[model samples]
Target: MSLIMRPATEADIDRLVDVYFSAFKENPINIRVFPESSPQSRAFWKKNLEGDLKEDYVRFQVMETVDEPKTIAAFAVWNAPQKATNPMPPMPPLSAWPSDGEVDVAAEFFYDIERQHKRFMGPLEGAPEGSQQRPHWYLELIATHRDFQGRGAAGALLRYGEQQADAAGVPCYLDATPDGRPVYTSKGHGFREVESRLYQGGAYEHVFMIRDPRTSA
Candidate 1:
């Protein structure tokens, strides 16, 4: 079955929420941060994604099957290095997240990652939407629908992000889960693990990786 990658639109949000929950249903971070297993959980995810979509530097991309009435097989949320002409607004503090979403656990996990992000990439600067010292494309989130995991849809999205980073002569970065580290490091992906850190107060961990831009000889 053929798969295609393209920019996701508002119309795709509902389906994307489905893809997200279906894909990450078993993930540790997903479980810890989004503990609600009810309809309210789905609603929270949808609202969160909707907010992310409205941000200037955030880009939502999807990979879908080629058959008619195509299914969204996988999706990625990327944070492009901000341009001065279109700077990103500050994000709300984790404290502001709804209690139903397990905001405390999410804050613990995300704050841990933010510590690594700042140490390795430098703090984010508002002037142009990039790190103070090292600018790079950040993969904020990615998920493959359970039915399509083995079919390479996620790889296509990774390659698509890599192409964009290569075009801009910048590195691509991500925090890879235990289940995702292998794929990120597989041949052709070029990601090298730079650090491993525990999150959720040692309940789980994620690996930070970077793939430097390919240069012509």
Candidate 2:
């Protein structure tokens, strides 16, 4: 089936949410490894995506079925330079967050992977929430619907983001998952062989990878 890529609109968020949740459902490693399961993770991401989409700082792209308007294939986005973004809810005692989707879904995500791999996913550094302005593009999220896996939707989304970066004359960067590292490397993104890493829960290591769209664009 043919797919069309375009700027994601508010009308597409529901489908985007469905695609994301479906992808996560299809990847149990992501579920058991992540901290957002138990019924509320879906709602958590929905809140994040919706709030981010409403922000001028966040940009998103989605691929949809050309033949079936009801279907969404995948979506990718960059976010930062936000204005007073959502704050993390208070955490429970004696926990970085929670193994469950309690204080923060994102942190739960970190816990999921950290607990699974026994390594940090990336450097534990970020500008204070909404306080730092990102000069380049950040790949905040990307997901291909499980139904559409092996169909090149991820590559399409990557190319689309790079095109945007090229048009803006900026580079694109992302904190790559172990599963995503080879994929991004195949597309010419390079890892910061140095400090762009994390040491979480002890030995878990998450590395960062970036693409200079100026070259590949």
> Whose TM-score is greatest here?
1
Compared with the true structure, what per-residue lDDT tens digits does model 2 show for residues 15-113? 887787777673433554344454455555566677777867677888888994547899987653223243321212324322564344345445443
Off by over 4 Å in 1: 83-92, 95-98, 123-133
Which numbered prediction scores highest in lDDT against the true structure? 1
Candidate 1, poorest ten consecutive residues by summed lDDT: 83-92
Please, what are the lDDT tens digits per residue for candidate 1 over residues 41-109? 677768778887897777788998889988899999988876434323333577555566777776777
lDDT for every model? Answer: 0.78, 0.60
Candidate 2 runs further than 4 Å off: 26-39, 80-134, 187-205, 215-217
Report clash pairs, candidate 1: 82-129
**If scored against the real structure, what TM-score would every candidate get?**
0.85, 0.67
lDDT of 1: 0.78
